[model samples]
Target: MKNTIFIALILLAGILTSCGSVKYFGIETFTPAEITFPETVETVVIVNNAVPQPKKPGYKYTIMGVEQDTTHMVADSALYDACKALGEAIADQPFFKDVRLYNDAVRQDEFFFQDTKLTPDQVETICDESGAEAIISLDRLLFNMEKDVFPFGEVMAGTIKVQATAVLRAYMPGRNNSMATIYLTDSLFWSEGASNLRTLDSYLPKPEVALRETAAYLTSGAYRNFVPHWEQAQRWYYTNSGTRWKQASAFAAKEKWEEALTIWQSIYEAQTNKKSKAEAAANIAVGYEMVGKFNEALDWAKKSLALFKEQTSDEKDSNVALLTLYEQVITSRIQANNKLNMQFGKE
Candidate 1:
């Protein structure tokens, strides 16, 4: 079975009506590219196109033109480290058979960080070497930093702003089609003060330190884009009507969800007045939704609407509009649940 999901679901979580207590759900954050590989595409190779710029013997470095001990070039393997992390993450997915994390070529002539697309020859070579069905290439992984140092009366202050962008592309064996690319970007800012020449010169983080920090921040959450993700979501439930309703609301607030549902069901079944029954039915529907029983919730929502019309048999009830709106909300929630369940729930 195939499932479809949209990134908009996360944005809609904040939308709510203040009729009752609240509940929670889990939803996917971003939409992934269309994955249309053949059934035999069970293996993938996550390769780093980035060339290793290992530090040379006794390489000198400087900060603000004042020789400092910031050798970001020595930490240049951070790209490879991030690639290792991505490979590990994919390995845990169980959807693939084998994965090769790296290629040991000491490429010294190419600007791998800026190359977004590999030549057809490069792609074929990588696949041939790894014997994988597809390849995920790190198109570019580079960071630039801005350093500003100014002097105060007896003290100096400095600010460092760093920005990093990582571009990734997936290549597979198939007839020609649009390949999927994942782009991630992040920016960081920090400042410090110094009182003397020594401190002033080293007021901010060293280049390697800053680069490592930025890489950690960038790669911390970047791998999620390549796989399915579940993020927390907030939702509201109606809980205001009478004593039993208030008690049920309190139970739900305490996370005694089953107790709350039982009380609401009692109120719904025992009430003889159409208005009271309609209100209770709406509460019960919300209860079902809290437990992820969206189909049942939808059915109870329809029942609430039927009772609401009966309550307004004389066309005098002012709550008719509110009940109609509540029914619409239930309908929309059902539709959202259908989509969310398909994406995150078991098939």
Candidate 2:
């Protein structure tokens, strides 16, 4: 009996120790609320105008070929492939909804020979013809096959470095005639190198798949970088009326922690309603937890609990659901604090 009891206690201690280990300490946390764009504001409509052909065009695409810098033998097949890939990439963007590719062989060949240069007049004509809100003109300055070292060590690696610049211009015909241009002077070098068992074709995949994957990557990266900016944008929309507070709640639903935090913080600081202020304080703690700031979370949780306690009239006012949630917060904090203490060998 004595031996069994001792073994049980040891096992319990082991269990506690295992529970205290923070394996994914900062990895996974609560997502902030969802963000819904205001329904009243209309989404901007955009379109892609066709590429203008040069006056003396031969091939459908003027520069549809791979040009060897050393030899100067242009490969027709390579150039066509590249142009097709670029057209697919541009077509995939949400901003370019309505797109029309021009089919003038003479003009296209001429433009290609001129290093894909398009005059402002040509761009305007294309925009007017296509009835497109925006025009994206593509030009391939240099498309060359080259050898490159893979970031991950690999033998016999090569790349197709597509060095081209594109210009995107937004043109409004009648309304103020505002013109906005963006220069896409970036190199998209795709490595032919693959893992030990994979080939270059495997790595490059189809243009559609590759372009979609790239779009997803860009969109995710942009959102991650723009979290703070989006939060600030939300603040401008927040007002004293319950509407802004409700908007903040909607953002919280979408797991937009930063925006929800900002709005909740504002409400906590500025709201006159005691209940709303307390709720905001509690939500701020939740936001901190989502961001992996456990210490700040605990502090805010304590503040919320104190406010809740002050607001409660008696045991009658403290309903079961509210009490349970409050207890969960306190219990979770205690466990977290205890685990932190144990990790540091605190007394």
Candidate 3:
């Protein structure tokens, strides 16, 4: 199924209010999988066991029934770069005591996917050599590449496309078992203009260049499977309360979260005016989110709604319009959070 389009669901007016309010909330846009390891697994090593893509140039190929034997066609480096990225990402986190990227690939003879996986014995030997408790083996990295020439204004452009699929297996030698094995598929598309279709190869880059660039994006992205990460997310707040908004905005700009929260909390609790109180409560919600206290953020959101309900006293009050819009915004957040929980197992 096509991914659900969030544009229609997003509260555009809330997007408007956030800019006006000088407030932002930390929304969990990405929920990566949790990492697992044996108790003895203090360090992990990554190795490439996949069959290497042919690197030799001067290979003849029939493209669109046109034959060409090209030179300077180097090897594909996607798997190697991905292996390095995974190790670097793990080392960047405090979660791992140590991480190593093995430069020497585990040479294999098989050219097919199923035949290229590392055996359990190979995994043990790699762990012993690298002095790692576990091993992340790149079993296979296969790419189906295609190039097409399409009309681009007065000229023509060649699109280089690739679908990369691979299997990565995590083995814990200490436990004598596999921790996690995942198959991933990623695709990339790039365009280069050409004056004519026949000369497209001359205009386009070497296949290895497109392969490396595509691999960089696709492989580094999949590395998130082993760790939790944060992604930028957009959220909205109320700024109609004017002075309190400015007061809170100043503190936020200074990065003094506690001081701003203090001011907003005071307005939320002690303000005599209902409108001011509700807006303050909403700001308080944003404050909680900014500090990564999502449960409190949710609680304050409920409190804001309750105040709105109290002010309306019925569904027909003039304040009901604002309340309805706010309700839609909150409901959208709840839906998004529910999706996050389901995907990441209730973080």
Candidate 4:
């Protein structure tokens, strides 16, 4: 009886092992799913007419003091430092590429100390000689200093305001001309605490930041305005009727269905006469046919034909093109409907 019990246990263990093996072999496994990155799109800067010059090494500038006085001598260092700082700040901008700031070499001479007025032509000539695109001409009217205390009595502060104007003229080497002239009048405000006073230094970084931002804004605006083919299509269409009609015909010939349709829609909206509206509608229908929108095309074509038939006078010559377009739309729509019926096994 013990042998018989042992035999039954052995058979049960073998069956369980086979079942485990079968289950292990039956299950399927796979590697984790893979992911893909999007394609990189290149940024295109369109430059037509005169190509913008490659941003070169830093530009050199001559900073000249346009005024002279006893008080001006006392404030000379501060004024010079301020102009140099402003030049550095502008050059640091991304658009500037590179720049160098320098004090005017001809100092306290006839041109520098006298009541000299530098005209635009004179400034341009200076720019040409210096190999610089811009110049910083300083004329200081007033530099005043004042003192105040903090509310909590933590520190005393001294403030200085420098009133002046800066002119930026960009040169177009390719065109052999200077483009737009920019003028910025700024009141430079500076403040210093007791510690800053001890250091003999105090100027707000805010003013410099604001100045750089303003320059960047002006430069971008100028570049955009200078671009030749950047005007809107709608504006072009409104200004030149012949050009607009030619564009409409060209778009239709190229099978640019949507563009052609848009041009015709504009014409229809602008037309006051029934004949012009009918003609526009007929052309619009032909555009729709090119886009495979047969029903819409057929509708517009029928409307155009009805208008042509209802005209009081025989203006057949005026509508010859429109009539031809209408017939083409009707024929195409019929063929398309027949094709659709056959596709669905209805005919």
Candidate 5:
């Protein structure tokens, strides 16, 4: 089934107005993945091929600016956590028909080397055994842990940071080369300030917990390249003081876009001031966005931007900035829509 293509408007509380009368709402936008796979590969298998952190010496971890012999920092479960996260993320998408997780480590002996590749025969065997069209191999997962503590006057502040790097590859049965190779690095940080050192220490996550969390974060982003995802974005509409503007805002608050759009059209037609007309046009563009009319939204947003520039004679005006931002948002959505169509096999 085609994913529902409609903007979801959410009203923000407390601080509603910006630029005197411009109020903003939240809208959900779909962003396309960085890579688009062929539609023929519908089922995917996620495998862990990375070796776990060894218990032997030579790997040092720095915490609080001191090297510590810590047993909890050994990341025995890092590969498992990363592979599980990738599988879960892929399963969340409706684009793939099935997702399988291979629990065993395919390359347990490979720890220092990074240039390893799965042979074509191995890819075929894995796909055949898992009943999947392609394989997503978690090739390598490595981490570096660091912590810093400082004293400021009477307070103690500490920060714990974990750096993770992961390499992943995609392979089909007959392909000699990987369909995609994703090499990503990510960092997770936790900072807390307390009256005492003990309190600050209690606020940070344990070493074991931090290891798993960092592993998950490293691989979770790889799923974005395989599927389209929704991102929350802010969009503003003008509600300057007026009965008609207030009425339209009320209707828009209820998600009645057509009703609000009707009033905004009337206001644009009758308003003499360029600023007022620009406000109405901007609101109309948001209404069109709510109804999934992106082309129309882009058109009205351009008109509103032009009007704002004409009214202020300066591009630095707040209203001009607002319209400029909205124009960029609409343009991005239009581009994402095109990529989404290709990913969904509509193109």
Candidate 6:
């Protein structure tokens, strides 16, 4: 009975070893923007064209049996912050020759708060005065807030939520139509619990501050639409009981990708097992990708996938799944690089 049990244990270990395992590593890849701008729009001016909100009506709330009145409305500072933050983010891009902020409010009489577009004359004037090639206007900004107070077990819990919506339009000096119109909305929330309602209220962010933060956050990400950005992504590699494979992974861990590629190439040439050869090809593809040889990287990735299909009987092999994803990623990178080159004014 002891000998039989030992034989079963040996078989289990062999099966586990043959299954293999995978290790993950991180890579930062350049991704294309949501929208691309024309080469003519090198300089941009951000303008505050929004009309500020009037005073809000007063409302009463009960805090621990005491009544209090409060009024909240959108402040002028929030609009300014939205414009300023967007301008700063655009300026960070090396493609833009200049970035200017027209801090003064341009529209003051929109009492009905209509969705008004900037006239061609206004766009030309702003571009000429700011020495910018394009005009980016904060057409309108709207804000609303809600507050709630409730009993949570024993203590009183208070929550404050604010939502801000912004309308932006882009124009070129000679164009009759706007280049782009974008609408963005963002929300902020704060919650706290205290023995009494008044303390919880004090702990929450003020309405004006919340509005400013939400607006700023909304505009901060808008620059990416006009420029390529870097995004961090993950990739997987095969690992097993081979000393040479372990050595190659060590070199890759230190980011010595050239040295790692040399070892992986040697392993791929000498490897007799189809699975081992496929793993080596996958690692080699990643190494070529790290070195900016995307065309070669894509070729090697295809080779790895074909080999994996031949050796993998289960169709759901982890190596096959990863190779499929890696192949797709390389293909996308190739396409995005073409767009990025155009955005950078390279042929």
Top of the candidates by TM-score:
6
lDDT (Cα, tens digit) per residue for candidate 1, span 1-347: 11211122222223323323333344332223134344466677877765533443223443455655554344465677667767777676555677676565324555544454666666677777888878777767777666666665667777777787787777875425326777879888888888865776566677567766776577656555554444443334455557887898788777676798899899888889776787678767767877777688778878877887875575434344444554555565565554444444333
Give lDDT tens digits, candidate 3, residues 1-347: 00122332134434445456334343455443445453456788888877666654223334444554553334447778768776777677665578888778786565634535566787878888899887877777766666656677887777667677777778775445567777878888777776776677686766777666655566566556665455454554555546766787778666676788998887677788887787788778767766766677778877876787887667754334444544454555565555555444554
The candidate that wins on lDDT is: 5
Q: CA shift at 11, candidate 4, in angstroms? A: 98
lDDT of each: 0.62, 0.42, 0.64, 0.41, 0.79, 0.77
| Candidate 3 segments exceeding 4 Å error | 1-33, 38-40, 53-77, 92-97, 107-111, 115-119, 150-156, 196-200, 271-276, 292-295, 305-347
State the RMSD for candidate 3.
6.3
In candidate 1 the C-alpha lDDT for residue 289 amounts to 71
lDDT of 5 by residue, 1-347 (tens): 01221121222211336335767766677888877778888888998877776543324445456766754466768778888898898789777899899866677573534647788988998988889988889877777777677776788887778888878888888888988888989989988889887888798777768889999988886888777887766666788779999999999988999999999999999999998998899899999999999999999999998988887667766677666766777887898889899988999
Worst 10 residues of 4 by lDDT: 22-31
Q: Quote each prediction's TM-score.
A: 0.63, 0.33, 0.70, 0.27, 0.81, 0.83
Worst 10 residues of 5 by lDDT: 1-10
Deviation from truth (RMSD, Å), model 5:
5.4
RMSD of each: 7.5, 18.9, 6.3, 29.4, 5.4, 8.7
- For candidate 2, lDDT tens digit of each residue in 1-347? 32343344344334433554101111222221112112221222223232332222211211114432332223333333333444444444332334444433213343343433345565556556656544333333223223233434654344544333334333343434334444443434565665542464456533333333332332222221101111110111112347767777677567787898988888799877666666677667767766667677667766765676677756433221233343354345456455444323453
Cα lDDT of model 4 by residue, 1-347, tens digit: 32333343234334434544100011111111011101121111111111111112111111122221211213333334444544544443333333444435322332222322335564555556655554433322122222222322555454444343333333322334334444445444555665443432344333334333333332333322211112111000111245666688677656576997898889878977777677677777666765767678788777776776677456443343335434553554466455444433456
Per lDDT, what order, best first?
5, 6, 3, 1, 2, 4
Regions of model 5 farther than 4 Å from truth = 1-19, 56-73, 111-115, 147-160, 189-209
The digit string of per-residue lDDT tens for model 6 on 1-347 reads 32333343334334434665556566778777656667767888899888875546322234444555656555678888899889888788676888899857888694626767888898888888888888888888877766677788999888777777888888788778888888988887788999885687688777678778878888888877655777666665566678998998888888898999999999999999998899899989988999989989999999998999998587766566566666777877898889888777785
After superposition, candidate 1 runs with Cα above 4 Å error: 1-43, 50-75, 88-100, 105-114, 119-121, 152-154, 175-178, 200-203, 241-243, 250-259, 266-286, 297-347
